[model samples]
Target: MKELFPLKQVMGFAFSIFFTLLALAVYFFNMSFTIGMTVLLVTAFLQAGLQLVVFMHAGETEDKGAIYTNIYYALVIALVTVFGTLLCMIWGYV
Candidate 1:
């Protein structure tokens, strides 16, 4: 069936490959470091999410909500720790 074929998944894979190639092009061509890094980061994050959701079916199980909640909490904590360090150390806000 078409579901088994998963055209959407194919498209997502193609897009991932395209973004990877684009990143390589930026690197090989010696483009602006800031721009290249930004693009690479964006694409890398997006591809990771796509792979998680599509291929891994991260939210398909009954515990998906719990999983996502845990992820969110972890992200919040990470952000706080990172920002706190930057604030205290770099910004001299202690």
Candidate 2:
């Protein structure tokens, strides 16, 4: 019965809630834009990683390397697209 408790999942959920509350605090505390954004981004990435590892079981598969590689590739593409758009539209780099 002890092994059936799903401790990892419960801990992950609790951490997720904590991160959510931390993000919310940035708004309630009226933090500066930079600080708020920093906190939010940190929590968002941490939550995403936690969900991937804990809930999605990303590291439990034999092909975990491939899965993580794909994720990294996707992140790189997303960053490039976002930064490219910002450079052209907002930074006037066109």
Candidate 3:
């Protein structure tokens, strides 16, 4: 029974559920827009990391460092793209 128990996955699933509920609460509780967005963003990133590490087995491979490095690069690119767009289109930084 112990050998068959998927503890990590179960914990990850529970954490995911908790985060989902937290997001729902933040949405339905009529929180301020900025605070709500901040909470949601933080929870989203945490959930994403949990899913990647627990479900995706990100640390199981020999090239785990490369995998994490690539993920970081992707995140940087995404952030740059989003911020650049916001600056140019919304903030009128052209």
Candidate 4:
């Protein structure tokens, strides 16, 4: 029975639940825009990282370093794409 339970996965599940609840609270409560956005952003990033490391087992394999590097590259590209779009379309970069 003990061997059946994956402790790390359980912990990850709990943490994911916690982050979800926190996000819900931010949505339900009448928080200031800046505060709400900040909290939501922080929780969102944490949840994503937790999901990757725990559920996805991102660091368990022998090629973990390469995997992490690829993830980082993807993240950088995503950020750049988002910000560039915003700058050009929303912020009026010409």
Using TM-score, give the best candidate's number.
2
- lDDT to native, each model: 0.84, 0.98, 0.95, 0.95
Candidate 1 lDDT, 1-94, residue by residue in tens:
8668988778878987887887788878887889888988788778777787778887899999988888788879988999999999999999
> Per-residue CA lDDT of candidate 4, range 1-94, in tens?
9999899999999999999999889878978999999989999999999999999999999999999999999999999999999999999997
Q: Which segments of candidate 1 are over 4 A away from where they belong? A: 81-94
User: What does candidate 3's lDDT look like per residue over 1-94, in tens digits?
Assistant: 9989999999999999999999988978999999999999999999999999999999899999999999999999999999999999999999
Tens-digit per-residue lDDT, 31-93, candidate 2: 999999999999999999999999999999999999999999999999999999999999999
Instruction: Give the worst 10-residue stretch by lDDT in candidate 4.
Output: 23-32
Count of steric clashes across candidates, in order: 0, 0, 0, 0
Candidate 2 clashes between residue pairs 3 or more apart in a chain or in different chains: none
Q: In candidate 1, list every pair of residues with a backbone clash.
A: none
Better of 3 and 4 by TM-score: 3
Per-residue lDDT, model 1, residue 48, is 77
RMSD of each: 2.4, 0.7, 0.8, 1.4
**Cα-based TM-score, every candidate:** 0.70, 0.96, 0.95, 0.90
**TM-score of model 3 (CA atoms):** 0.95
The order of the candidates by TM-score, greatest first, is: 2, 3, 4, 1
**TM-score, candidate number 1:** 0.70
TM-score (C-alpha, index-matched) for candidate 4: 0.90
* Residue 90, model 4, lDDT: 100
What TM-score does candidate 2 get on C-alpha atoms? 0.96
